[model samples]
Target: MENNRVKKQPPKKNLWKPEEDLILKKYVEAHGEGNWATVSQKSGLKRGGKSCRLRWKNYLRPNIKRGRMSQEEEDLIIRMHKLLGNRWSLIAGRLPGRTDNEVKNYWNTHLNKISPLGKRKHVDSNDQNNTNSTETTNKKSKIHTYPVISIDAQKNPTKESNGKKEEGSTSLLNPLMTDTKSFSYDTESPFIATNTSTFFFDDEPLITYMDSFALFEGFGYTTGENYAELGMQLVSP
Candidate 1:
């Protein structure tokens, strides 16, 4: 049996109207925020609950710090990002009124260009170093296990001519997986194992984010003069 996997396409973005925003804002104001499904239903807005929640939280929500991220916020984001890579919600938790989406967008737009990980490199066997590690997240005391990216391939990759595959070859059209390659993950992170010499996924999402995660024994940032400990972080205002 040939099993064909369907790729999930992102939902089409529908712009929110002024009236819709007004209704969502008023409803949230009157009833506090929670139960997004109820808000989507009771508000009579033809939008998904996720959409309604994001709209309210990102735009309609009160006390959202907007217009120009402060120097302090940028520094905090950088420090926090160093401690926690691509975990936007955890990074945003340190910043008041800043949602994960907003933080991610800002990083992708502005900070990414300036950071070391932003530098583009040719997708080759060397990139395999970045993709070949299992991530472990330890928050509080509980240990969360991430998918182990296990790929066994040499520096040199085999090339395919005329884009032709053998009759008994796999269904996946990607020629990058010429050798033994299997990329599967149960978690949300969509990783594909490939011989990096020929091709690979975008470095920003999987390669840099995963490879850039350089953590010590615990959470905190350090410099020659000052070592800021984790106890001082997320201090309530």
Candidate 2:
């Protein structure tokens, strides 16, 4: 008897084209990345979401700042790689503008090559540990050496002076006194006390002397045929 089981075929590669990369770079330069599906459709590229995103992040976008790494940058990469352990996304965050794929490719191509040159006498836990102990050993062995620089760290050196000036400008230290003529500062108004003290509340809607005076003096709404009614209609619910 013959067997009829079939082997599964591999998926087709989503190769990045030069023109596609150029279009992605241009569009991203104009409108920043992240909306990959919409971007691909707009750019007329046949690439999928993941592929388009990877292409733009890893290859395109200006100020990429690739090539030979500085000693400080390299040190950060080494420390991050050890701490994060092949977590390209996490490691890439430590180095601005650098992609996970770029970091991974650099680690595989460059770092691995140079790692042997500066190899210490100590055994690499990754190589020495058994499969079960590997994860635990690797976790404890790798240590982060550098202090991660942040936005606050790299903020304006004169920020303290600016902040001090800003704090001084606010009424935090010195309190303000409000005038009572145009503005009222009373905790209990005379009108409020008069209303609560007297049991007689006018059924004809008693207008305050100040309010009537304000209307008479044209400081408030002028008496008209339908000014109040018109005003009421204009106000939203």
Candidate 3:
């Protein structure tokens, strides 16, 4: 007595070539689609029916989109994904010139970063926590090291006579400043740089800086508390 068992063969998975593609395309065009079983035997291709179907449907389709997905397409995919929940075939059917596999692949690789659906709330919470921590740290590390300045713009320093003014002095504080325009006072400008080399008051060089509007640096008008700390006096003519 002789007993025998037959082993089932696995499906063909040979890579498709250009000539094979041409042959398959022509055959499909001639005979029409929807019959993948006899594609290998009838069309003389070494690839299995499943492989032929995939190649034609996914890549070789005439109306398929070839370039990168447009913003409109991406938005649509996201919307559809939210509604349909990974039903790629249904989603692809809604979009013109797009295939199921292409949509599936795009969603798997690209859609996760942008999709609003299935997003966790913990991410936002973590961001808020970090922001609060940063704010607290900044408040703790704050310092008040701003420079103090006093402004008293006397037109003629010789009359006030704070410094010694010798008679017939070549470069004296008689007129105080030669380049009055260098002082360039304007309420609109932040600060004015002045050339104070016009005098050596009692044989000492004097440099002047004035931004009387807010003469102090780091005096940002950010808070009501900061505004309250500021003071100024108006001079009468």
Top model by lDDT, which number?
A: 1
lDDT of 1 by residue, 1-237 (tens): 455676676666688989999999998898878899888889888888899999988888876878888887887777666556666765665566777889988877888667544543442445434431123232432233223323232221112344232221111111232333222222212122212211122212332232222242122212211222322211111
TM-score of each: 0.52, 0.42, 0.43
Question: Candidate 1 at residue 112, lDDT?
Answer: 67
Q: Tally clashes: model 1.
A: 0
Candidate 1 similarity to native, TM-score: 0.52
Model 2 CA lDDT for position 78: 69
- Candidate 1: give its CA RMSD in angstroms: 21.5
Q: Model 3, residue 21: displacement in angstroms?
A: 1.1
On lDDT, who's better, 1 or 3?
Answer: 1
1-237, model 2: which lDDT tens digit per residue? 365675666657657767888888888888876788788688788777788887776777665768776675666666545433555565564455667778877776778566543343444546643222101334443343222211111111122343231111101010121311121112111111111211111111212112222222232332332223211111111
Task: Give the candidate order by descending lDDT.
Answer: 1, 3, 2
Return the number of clashes found in candidate 2. 0
Task: Looking at model 2, report the run of 10 residues with the lowest lDDT sum.
Answer: 165-174
